[model samples]
Target: MYNSNYYIPDLVEIQRQGFFNLLEKGIVEEISKRNPITCFEKQIEIFFYPEYYRLTKPFYSIQQAIFYKKSYVSKLYVPVQITDRKTKRVFLKWMLLAHFPLMTNRGHFLLNGSARVIINQLVRSPGIYFRENMHEIYSNKWSEKPSTSFRRFYADIICLKGTWLRIECDKDFSMWAKMKKGPKIPLLWFLLGMGLSEKYILNSVHKPMNLLESFTKEIEKNQRAKTFKELKYPYVSTSKKAWEQIQKLFKLKKTLRKSSSKNTFETKKSSIVSSSFTFFIQKRTEEKYNKNNETKSKKRIKNVQKGDPKQNSEKKIGSQLEAHELGRKWFSNKFMNPRTYDLGKQGRWSINKKLGLTIPIEQTTLTALDVLMATDSLMKIEDGFLEIDDIDHLKNKRVRTAGEALQEILSVGLIRLEKSIRLKLNGNTKQTFIQKNSFFNFHALISTRPMNGAFREFFGTHPLSQFMDQINPLAEITHKRRLSSLGPGGVSRDTATLAIRGIHPSHYGRICPIETPEGKNTGLVNSITTYAKISVQGFLESPFHKVYKGQVQKTLGVFFLAPDKEEHFQTATPDLRLTSLGFLPKNPIPVRIGKRFVRMRSHKLALMGVSPLQMISVATSFIPFLEHDDANRALMGSNMQRQAVPLIRPERPFIGTGLEARVVSDSGHAVLSKTSGYVIYSSGSKIYLYTF
Candidate 1:
């Protein structure tokens, strides 16, 4: 019977939070003491008594929370925020609760606990439940790759009312959740849950059918009471054999714990004394961290330049969260697939390889294309002007032995037709035309069927286009941007100018200088700021830059970037600081910008709104229609006609996708056909030999 009663669920939720707080506190102490890095060697907790992981809790009142089932536990998860203890403490308190942790093991304790060894083995096995996890949460703010931990952890977790919550290093949260007579929802809580499901269940890790009993047995077996029945340390009094057994047990622990257990306590008083001493040590460690933070803030006032505004701006640059994860292969497959990719990127790569250049979207391909486009269609073209069927002459042939090429190129695609009339004027006609308009431009001779499909989809008139549809991300870019000072400054003679330069427009002069006991601190100022935006058809890159865009019909990836350049407010947590991009000898190089910003593409004719997938369609449709400027052309063939192909970068780069491309000049330009409902490339570089 589900208890519509007291707070068992709340207690369970709160207990998890409390445990996280304690764990973080412990980690902070470890850092403060300059302890080596530590991590939890997790174990599948075994319930010794009630046959449930939840039953391991020593508190008798836990029964109050188990209304769902006294004997049944569908599943349990150990949602570890694989982050530093400090971050785990400050930002992720809510995460510890809401979901379930089969057990919360301390990283340091795992170094010696036998619990650590067994847990590692269990994780490798499929017997336990580990489901939809908030993977890869970074405690340090910046994370690169899909972290095994979770961030925005609060979004997925749900806590019942009346829960007792605890954070890392926190003793416990006894705050009354009794909602006072007030508005229906607290503004903060309401906002947090806004646009969210009315109710969200935990991303439950389903217990395996065969291993459910085994996992349950393990958790039930390992449940230890709050009081570990005092096993005499060393058990020396028993015999040499007893000592050997104790030594063996110690040996089984993680290296750190194995070394730590060298000393055995002889009495209860010693144990009590050790616990008390550990608490004080922990307290002292906390104080040290606080003092360090204070020192850092103070140092900023001292080290900043006496009076350099630009340098001041540099100092004003605060910390941010630029945690980009390692590239996902699926994301890369969007553009690259040498065997099955658009030759666009492959051509560029080939060029790069030939040039011995490491540029992402090889520049050589673009160069070759430019040259081809620049040349007149006099030589490469075989006829005076090419029609739809003429351009279809070339295509990928399934040549078992290079003899079946005709079957491939002659496939039914865009058809040829006459839409315009071209007249040849001789004496009488020339006289009439010359008298009427003095030009021979009125009569069109030929026409062609209209183009459609991915072409329309590319030109952006098609439905079910790859990007035009909405793709809600699992997590949003959290708005945590804060205005803070990171760089240290010293008192400058020209303090006024220095402070002005140091002020970032974000703060709106909220920061100012004060004549402190040590020196003069930079003061803030007030000034209205605006970004001069250009309505462009292009892609958005980082916070400050935009790439070229073709006519866009769809939105790509998580960030919605337009070909039109615009700068909105960058959103992030106020606590996080901005990090500059780091360059490495090899790429895809590790890079970072504002957390809210992503690099996108913009083309001359199209933009990012037209999905990258649609690009090929556009290029294919208008391949014959596009004319090469006289200046750049390298795609020229012996017939004096150019080919159609835009340059591209590798499918996946070190940082992001969408690299530069080159356009080759050809006789044909691709466009929509009025008669036909498909895209066709009309070649202009048709070859015609003049008989003089």
Candidate 2:
């Protein structure tokens, strides 16, 4: 490695890899699995099982697409096999799945002859994120005094595609849960619904006996007490009292169930019209009765209702229990079932990596152990044993490239296609299907419209999908490397807070601090640094050289470190002068480790940066004498560079930074000579060279 020198990495490799990944690993592997669509009742199964797919050499080339105003796309053919189990008959054929869009060499999709690029989105990663908020509540006392305030901690379990589960501690120190933004329910009740015994929960939260008592008292106050004024804080309750209350609640629930069972079930044929007509007749009959006798009849009706309080109470309790059971079932189906609440492979990996859990990555849905651990972490935060997360930090956010976005759209379209296949299978009976063997038209039954429509919807309406910026070669490449935080499943620009828009320490080398926009989207939209690359987990990383015991190891090469990993190592700046032998300066050097800026011995240094400009983007690095200019002016300078127009007689800058040559080479502006040659013939626009 060259000492104190930096080599430019592939700038547009991210975009290139993303598009190619979709074509290879994403679309073919995920969508071509065996038995993609199945209909058990009709004894039919449709397999996507890829026969072959073509990514390169599309049906319509880029030139043709531009001339004909068509999309440059490749055809996807899958071997579809339809099996009738009853008759043991099988129909096999190769069917067209879709006309998948193909990307150009410059990483752009040619849609309707216009080049488009999907801006990479910076989204909060899927995992349990903890937060604490303070709220003030009026005192129960009548005296005029300052209200008391309490800090409430919350843990949110975010999934890739399902309901969100938020657990928060109330002002009373009782834990409650809200699923899918539903009304708050006692954590104990939620656990109970999940089939956890009451005793187990009591044992779990009782480590801090006060939490258990508060939880039990809250349950009793909500269920038994009629007046809120009677409730008091700092509740002191024994285990016996808690057990007694729980038993009473169960008994009451049982009585309600028995009473509900006594009632007759409503017929499925009951219509809203019939119910309205009956109500109208009842009202008419009531009008015909004398006004004086109306009160007496109503009183008689009340007395008759009061005659069996148990019956009336049972009816009310039964409805409440039914609603409670319905909520339980809904949560189970939407949050617990693996089929409905898929977190995807990446989501599962993220959760496991974040929590350091040993659970298999294949278990994508939320589990009881995950809930318990998340809750425990909240308590740890309260006790100062754990750190609350900064949601805006790069560690908590990741890049969603075009590959992921396309895969999501494709998955949705495949689902729609599956539904259509199931409908067709259900419609045809075995007798009719056997009689009309010609009806087995795989092409007719399966339409590529769903996939095509999906692509159209994404390209037409998505905020991230934009017409390519072709003002200059720099602009075109910059457009592909752009990252935004506003889109579907991303933070709304209107509601984004200042904390989220401000620069953070983690962005030092990953995102360019000076290359953002100027107005509302100033920080929401940004560009990656020159040497920065995206990790497998989508985290941004910057290259650094390893320093071992006051010496820079040339053979070690450059190591890419994400923000989270970099925080653990002490890094020295490249400004420090090194000896001829590549040894560190013989003094306590000022180094940055984590958030602390301290002077440490050279032997303690872990990493040495390559250059000061490594933290800046290409546009910002191209400025001559950038250090002398103010940050605000430098930011404007960088912004204006992308808008620079090409000149008729192009000339290099008179006063320039050494980066001009590299930038020009990377921008695809100059065609470099590959071998020793001499120009034999030259024209006004072309140069012909003769080489040995």
Clashes of each: 153, 0
Stretches of candidate 2 exceeding 4 Å from the true structure? 1-5, 32-34, 40-42, 50-56, 138-146, 205-244, 247-329, 353-356, 430-439, 661-692
Best candidate according to lDDT: 2
For model 1, residues 1-692, the per-residue Cα lDDT tens digits are: 11121111110121133234423332232122211112232111111111111213322122332432222111211122212232222111111111111222111011111111000000010000101213354556665654454311000111111111111100111011112232121111121122111112011112111111221222232342222222121111112232233333333322424545434322322333223222222322333444679975344334432443543443322321110011112112322233222223333443343334455652211222221111111111212232111110101000010011111111111111111111121112323422243322222211112211212222132111112101111000000001111111212334445523342222211111111012242232111111111111111121122222222121222232322122233222111121333111221222223223343222222211112111111112122322232211211220121121224532322432121111111101122123533323335554333332
Local accuracy of candidate 2 as per-residue lDDT tens digits, 80-113: 7777677677788777777888777667889998
- What TM-score number comes out for model 2? 0.82
Question: What lDDT does model 2 reach?
Answer: 0.71
